[model samples]
Target: MSGPPTASEDAPIRVLLADDHDLVRTGFRAILGVEPGVEVVGEARDGDEAVQQAQRLEPDVVLMDVQMPGVDGLEATRRILGPSSPTSEVRVVILTTFDREDYLFEALQAGASGFLLKNASADDLVEAVRIAARGDALLSPEVTRRVIARFSTPGPAVQPRRPPELTDREFEVLVLLARGATNAEIAGELYLGETTVKTHVSRVLMKLGLRDRTQAVIYAYENGVVAPNGPSRDGSET
Candidate 1:
């Protein structure tokens, strides 16, 4: 309930907590304990220790906080995920008090698999780790919209209102998909079968020349599909 596991779990997600405050880590541990899945593998007082623990513990997820003492969270993230010799894939999820758009972009650029506001619900933190562990980027709808609004190029990117190739349903699915909704969630929202939603997702990815949902989300954002302050979907609102 408090975090990912210190050791291996039946759920197979080991988690490490990195924050400057001991009380914050304890609170996170208490909150994460009630969850059926997830466990707290270890804790670190700063970014450097976080990186070292990440290497040693090799947790499936690292809940990292920004603005730490030496080495800072973003730099630590870069070190962990950068071209290095870590045997395990140490997925990092930036969890911070701030909700700055710059932090979001910088975290993503630093090889973070996910970014979560510190105010995120327990459910969201859990789901974000799960999604990132599954190799998908975890973007909140608000985060996604901000990525769009801050980076969109307008006419050149949307002159023709998107290519005529995508079907209406496909386009709708793409928008939702890019908004960070999982296939199951999107299916429920759209009243479609999971398999059908998967098909639409796949088609959108292929047609848009995207490598995966994360890139597709970035594409949609940078192309004006979603805007900052727009309605939030994808179970990722504040």
Candidate 2:
């Protein structure tokens, strides 16, 4: 599948709002409407409509609600970002009033690029769109903590095997990424320039066929590349 959409430096970020509530949609539109570099391209009141509009509009970002009549947001997210999607470049940011763990985990598994609580401030909403547009995952601290906690729990023991395609440096980058280190932080730890770290990160993602860092984290844990709550392969604490 294609990577997330990239908005040019001079182009406004195109956005599609998908929520059952008109007021919620309107509120989002108002918050982003005034932003100079963001545009509300369309709105969808249900999951089916969301899927349709996302394919039709090909917006850079989709602000999706978790619960709505008909197909619901989680399914819509899968359809929008699924391998068969026509607009594979679109990034989905799940917006929900509920903070249930099931919804959070399911959203990520559905290929959502970000997840935001409905209680977030207007500024947070605007920043989320920009972040997703720039091909970054924007998980709130609480959500991020939940993800770490979930993966840190011990599962059945299995040997961790590294993908042969990744070099030693790329493997290190993936380990630090799974440990929640940012590119700058990874650079500091590895004594590499930020640009070089970014290159390693991109290479790690591309080699592993991951869509974003969030997926990289999930992949690391699931594949036992970095043991949860334990030292990495290099015998250093993650």
| TM-score winner | 2
**What lDDT does each candidate get?**
0.71, 0.86
Report the lDDT tens digits of candidate 1 across residue range 1-238: 0121232446656778999988878987787766667778899999899888988887888889988898888888888877554722577888865556677778776667677778888788778777766656666666665666655434444321453568878877877766568888899888999999978877776677553565666766656565434532232331
- Stretches off by above 4 angstroms in model 1 are 1-9, 83-88, 153-176, 179-193, 196-212, 219-238
Error of 1 at 5 (Å): 15
Tell me each candidate's TM-score: 0.67, 0.95
The true-versus-predicted C-alpha distance at residue 120 of model 1, in Å, is 3.2
Clashes of each: 12, 0
